[model samples]
Each structure stands twice: as C-alpha cells, then as structure tokens.
Target: MKPISWCSAVIKVERRAHAVHTLRFPAHLPTSSESRLPSVTSDNEIVQNIIAQAFSAIINLKHLFLLGQNSQPASIKLSTLASCTFSLCSFAGQVSGDLGIQEQLDFLLKHPTIEYWVPTEPFLRSVNSFPTNILPNLRQTVLVRPSLMKALGGRPIESLMILFIDITHSRAVEYTHGSLGPDWSTIDIISNLSRAAPNLKILTLGSLIKDDSVITAENQQSLVDAVARFCHLKILVLNTYMCALQKHTDEDPDPENPLEHSVAWEGRSPAQARQVATQFMTACPSLRRLSFPDTGPSPTNSLTYILSGTKAKLDGFYIIDNSGWWLR
Candidate 1:
C-alpha cells in the first residue's frame, strides 16, 4: 500500500479517530528504529492536503507535531487545521530543521491554547521570527536555544530543559554569528532564564563533555554563588560527565585501609559533583533534589543526586549503571 492510499484508509476511520489524542506529520519517512518521535512526512501538496484532511477529521487532538527535515525546506500546510483543534494542548512546530518555518507562524499566532512548543534549535530562535504573542500560554519547553528568552521574557513558564548534545566535539569556531552549531560557553543560561521565566521550578541542563565533571576545592565557592540566580528552582539536573559503567578499581585497595570508599567509578569521582550540588542547595534553598544523570541511552539504571538524609552519599553516586536521565 502506498502512502497516499494508506492515508485514505486511515480517514475512513474518522468516526473512530475522534478518540485519537495525538497527531504528527513527518516530512521524511523513518524506518522502524526511528521510533523516538513519529511524525508526518512527504511535502507533496496532495500528501500535505491528505494529512490536513486526516487531521481535520480527527476531533480530539491534544498534541500535534509538524517536523521538518534538513534535506529540504519545510512545507507543511496548516491553514485548514484551525477548526480541527478545540482540545489541542501542545503543538511542536518545525522541529529539527533550520529553514522554512515562516509559513507556520500563522497557525501559532492564532492559537493561545498551545501551552508547549519545541522549535528547531539555534536557528529558529536566533532569527526571532516567533513574535511574542505567538506563545502566550507557553508554560514548559525543551529549549536547545535560549536566545528565545528575549521574546519569551515574561511568561508564566514553569519548567525548561536546555539539552545540548555534541557527538563530534572537534569543530573550530568562527564568528559568522549563525546557528550552524550552538556555543553554550558564551551564553549565560541562568541569566537568560532569570529574565525570561522567573517562576520556573524544574530546570535540566544536559551537555556532553570530554573532561571530568569535578570542580576543585578552591573554586567551589564561586560556583555556588553563580547558581543562586533563580528563586523557585526546585530540581536542578546537570549531566555532562561520562564515566565507566563499573565500580571495580585497577590497583590494590590502598593496602592499609581495605574498606575505604576512595575507589573511582570508571576514572571520575562524584565527590565534586555532590559538593557542588550541596553548594547549589546552600545558595538556593528552594532546591530539594539535585541530580547528576548518566550520559545515556542505556538499558540499566541511570543516576541521581537528590538531597538524602541517610549515610548513602556514595550509594548511587559512583555506581555507573548507564540508564535513565534526571527526571526528564
């Protein structure tokens, strides 16, 4: 069965599709393993119309996604869906591509019930195309680009996750001043959030790093003061350090003290990470749980560093179980 004909078969179920709560449009078809995010594809005008017709027939959509691919410019039609979404709560517009989102701004502008938006990173936010009124009710977001905070300055946003993934960390920098790749070094995320979403509670900042995530004893004080920017930040998760997935030491166990817990997981220690977490709690007393999640996509357990009362500081600290992210 071809895609267009397949869509026709799906539309026949319009009577039953009223219960369908989510819809997605993927422009590039994905195979079985691309199940991370399923969406509508194909830019053919007929396909676009068919998808819109399918969406229009469904009456109970809560989440709608329109994804764009880097291979071509984005060309998803949205004008017809205005009457389709009486219950639409979340909408992801033009995720993953940089260009061709100018056409979708109309749909976002007219809809105030869309509480969440996940735009393509770096470029979309850098261009400032999303007028401030486009996302009036936006409360939570997965932000790969924080420059958008300027336009989103004073919303009632409650949560934000600044997730940065750098697989090949060997690129040179030139000040072409574009979003080809995001440089978090120069951007002060906390300052941006303090200005944009002052009421934010849960914030997750995940980055991929090559070095150990340990800070020295001398500079720990300064790091603590820097994190006191937000008032209601309860859960703060910083995941950048990667370590071995085992707790076995290489050399002899210090011969003198056999039961000492000085051994390292892989080659890095979570002592500094914990100390810094403590400092964050000290500076910002509202923080109840601080997590250092694993560098993952793992099948086992991940990591956490919440404020615990027991003597299990190193219980889940140094044990690298390659699993879940910090409360994401």
Candidate 2:
C-alpha cells in the first residue's frame, strides 16, 4: 500500500487500533530454556509481522509501544504514528547498532502527525549518531543521554516542550565515551551540551561524579558561563558534586603549613562557597526557582547580596536545604 493510501485508511478506522498492534510479553519465560530457543526468534518474528501487516492495512497508528526484554531487536519502521512509546522495559546491558533507531527518528521527524516519543535504551543510545533533521516534528521527547541533545541542535526541534535525560553512571559514561570518543573531560561534556540545546525549557542531568576535585575554578567558570547563555531555561536538574575539601600532600609549598582546603582555595575559606552561591543567585535575573542541595553553604554576605538586580522577576530560591519550603 502507498503511504498516502495507508494514511487515509488509518484515519477512517483509527479509534479501534489502540489494541490492534500492541505487543505484550508474558510475565514468566523459562530461565533454563536451552531447548526452546527458537521460540524467542519466533516471538520477535511474530511481533514484526503484526506491525508490518497492521501498518499496511490501517495506514494510521494512533499509539505504538515497542518494548524489548530479551535483548532482541525491537524494530518498527512506521514513519507516522499519532503517538508512540518504546520501552526496553528490562534491558540488562548495552544495546548497539544505528539502522533501527535512525529509521524511527527519521519517521518521527518527517511526520508532524506524531505527538510524543519515549524510546528505550540502546535505541536511544544511537541519538548522537543521527542526523540533525530527525525529530523536527517532535514536541515531547524523553531521552537518556546528552548526545540526544545533538539531535536538537540548530533549533530544529524548538517545538520541544519537555526533555528528560537519564544520565545514570553507565548512561553518562556512554554519552561521554560516544560523543567525546577518547578526548573526554567533564568540561567538554558541559560545554557541548550547553551549546547544543540552548532553547531547552526543562533539562535534567544525572551523573556519578567520582571526584569533586575535578571542578576547578576554570571548569566552574565554564559551567556558570553555560548557564548564563541559556536564557529560556526554566528548570535545571543536575546530580553532580557539591564541593571538595582539599587534603594535604607531602611536597607542600609552605612546609610550615601544608595545603589544606582553605590554603588550596587561595585563602578563600570554605565559607566562601556561600559567597559563590550568592553570586550565582545574583547572575540570573530571570531565574524563577533556584535550588542547589548541599552543593555548598548558603550565600555569605547576605546583606551585600542583591536580589533587587534580579529584574524583580525572581520568585523564590531552592537552596540545598529546606529554604524554599520553610519560606512557604
């Protein structure tokens, strides 16, 4: 069937399709399945056949959910589903390859008919490698890596209303390794993402930051600069280091007093962390809600801290503690 003709039929009988093409796996599959391996392949084949045949006949899919639990390929080439969600509900490890994921994004971008997308891991992992034109029609996307932000580069998907990134330890490592290749650094990760998804309204990042010491003055400036650039950001969630207390070493510049946290900070006491926070609060005038948990101390020199310069558009602050709640 031609794509157009199939579309019309889909429009004619769209209401009945919520259950037609759905695939659900049974709760229990034998763990000791040495003899029934063919069943796994047969199951995937059945799913693919159902989707292919259904698309050809109905021409329009209202909702589609493709989930994989057996590490098998969950392939769907339908270019224009009204709503779709793919959950690799239980993928034990990494999944790879570009062809299957690329096709889905291509279809999702080309057709304005699609309204939502929730792709699973391994498939979602390939977003960095996809071309810029994919997801042009996407309005809401739930992604698992920063590389997915590359797909949003150049404002192609400015229509995006929501974006969720699941940057767990393994996921963060995959993004860093995949996009940065070998020349990877925490600063590189922050800089590239800031530029790639400038218009993002809501953003979340989760990482297993191993060392707070990695956040030096230079990198900290990079982070602050990046935040300053994105004026439209309304919500930012990051799971990273708060601060690092320096430890003394053998070869001290001053033998009388080895480098302590205070010495390492160039005479700036740990209390200055609160001063830095105050500077941050002052920088973003349009900021509505600011929250940083235990990142450092509350801003010191509160009297000198100017919220008046905030353009009066500020609502409240979400300090690492219960400041926001207590004020309410």
Candidate 3:
C-alpha cells in the first residue's frame, strides 16, 4: 500500500432541520503536496475527476456550488447533488445528460433548495430538462448565450426573484442574427422565468446596441411584455443605443424608405417608444431604481416617456448615456 496526500474540500448541504457535509478530492493519488500546484495540473480531466470523487461521497448535503469544473460533464451525476440541500449552484462549461439531469430535478422537486444558478453557454441548451418543481426556489439566473434561452424555452420562469442577461458576447455578425442574440429574446425568457421564479426582483440587460441593427419594434414589444409580467421588480436596467439622432448627412444609401427610418434608429417609432414607457411603468409598480443608456433617434422622447410614466412610482433614476455628447 502506498501513501498519497489529498487536498480535502468540504461542502455543506442542509435540508429543513438536517445538515450533511462531503469532503472530496481527486482520484489519482498525489505524490506530494507540491504536485497540487497550478502548473502541475494542466489538464481539465484531472480537475473534473476530482469533482466526481468529492461529490460521490456525500449522501445528503445542502447548498452545492460547483464553482470549478475543468472539462467533464457536471450536471448528469447528481445522485449526490440531488440529495444535498443546494440553494445556490453554478456550472462552469456544460452539464451533460450523464449527470442525471432528471434525477437531480426529481430531487429538487422533493427538496427544493436551489435559489441561484449560473450555468455557462454550453449548459444552457439542456437546462429546460430540469424538473419544473425546482423553480419555486430559483430566484436568480445569469444567461450567457442563445442556447440558454432555448433551454429555458416554454418553461415557467416567473418564480424567479432576479435575473441578469448578457447577449453582448454573441459572435454573430448579421443584424438579424445579432438582434436575436441571447439578451434580445430575453424578454420572452424573462416572461417564462417570471412564471418559474415568481419572486423576481431585479433585471439587467446589456448589449452593444449601437453596432447591431437587429433590435426592432416587434422584439421590443415582446421584451416590454416580459417586463410587464414582473410583479415584484424593483431594479431595472436597460442598455441600448441613442445614436439614431446622429447620422452623417453625406451618407444616403436610400432616402425614401420608411423601413430605413425604423432601421436607421435601432427600431424606434413614436408608438413603440410610448408603449415601452407605458409598459415599464405598469409592469413594475414598486420600482425604486431604474438605469438605462439614452441613445438612438428618439432618446429624448424615450427618456421623457419613461420618466413621465415612472415619475409617481420611481424612487430614483439615473441616465448614463449621451453624457459627453450633451456636454458639447
């Protein structure tokens, strides 16, 4: 028999009145403590195997957070995770089927403990497969790509308490594809999230709307509806372009097209602007803080309508766009 040193990482999992802790480490026997250095472990396979070993031991734990998994599927092997009391869990790259997505979901149904989840782009595609009952405790989520939205599609997400979506990372070059980025469709995503995570309190959307031509009126309306569904939203942040008011006079590819006007301004119309303001005001009646960039063709009108509608309800508001332009 050979002696091997192990780095023990302990995790705590708690249920109603019970608590369980699991200590996990890598499978391969380490020669010495020096072998655990950042340079010694170069392959991700070693890291994930370590996770598997750690999670395999505990029968029932509470609040699981897989902050670091190198390359193996972490979502499927939830026999151990399901038994634990997980209020917050995060997966780095992808959660494969082998991880027992359904079993984990069933466990969540019987014992709903997860409150916050952050799964990367690769895991988003299969996220919808989780049990619906687990949604009750899911309060916050961070979406990374379009696949994530698809995974959550048709699921009741209204039960959430807070959500943060980032679509600016999309690599799509076409405006059509770009506008349909993860954050764009997030309006509908939030709608579903609202149903699943009903206590949703905070929402944030950030993208480079100035460079993309995909954000239009129809998509805007859908997003507005999602916001309208948030009965408990207190903080809302929306980031878009306000460069519509600035276009080169010499640049005239077409002058008589109405679609050009809408396209020119990132899909801004008098009616849509008014509707956005109205919907936001009506959706979050208890709103305390609102922040958004003022850009595009009708920035002034958009700001006016949003402020006017939320004036009675808003506790505080901050305008972060067009700061330098206004100074000149």
- In model 2, residue pairs whose N, Cα or C atoms come closer than 3 Å (at least 3 residues apart or on different chains), thus clashing, are 6-59, 293-320
| Model 1 vs. true fold: TM | 0.67
TM-score on alpha carbons, each prediction: 0.67, 0.52, 0.46
**What is candidate 3's lDDT per residue for 118-234, written digit by digit as tens?**
554433434544444554545455654333434444443422212223222423222223223434444544566556445556665544333442246446556656667767777
Top candidate when judged by TM-score against the true structure: 1
Regarding TM-score, does 1 or 2 come out ahead?
1
**What range of 10 consecutive residues in model 2 has the weakest lDDT sum?**
319-328
Those runs of model 3 whose alpha carbons end farther than 4 Å from true positions after fitting are 1-61, 69-111, 145-199, 208-229, 242-284, 294-328
Candidate 3 yields a Cα-based lDDT of 0.42
Across 139-184, the per-residue lDDT of candidate 1 in tens digits comes to 8777555556666776678877765431112131222222323343
Alpha-carbon shift of residue 9 in model 2 (angstroms)? 19
lDDT of 3 at 283: 61
- TM-score, prediction 3: 0.46
Ranking by TM-score: 1, 2, 3
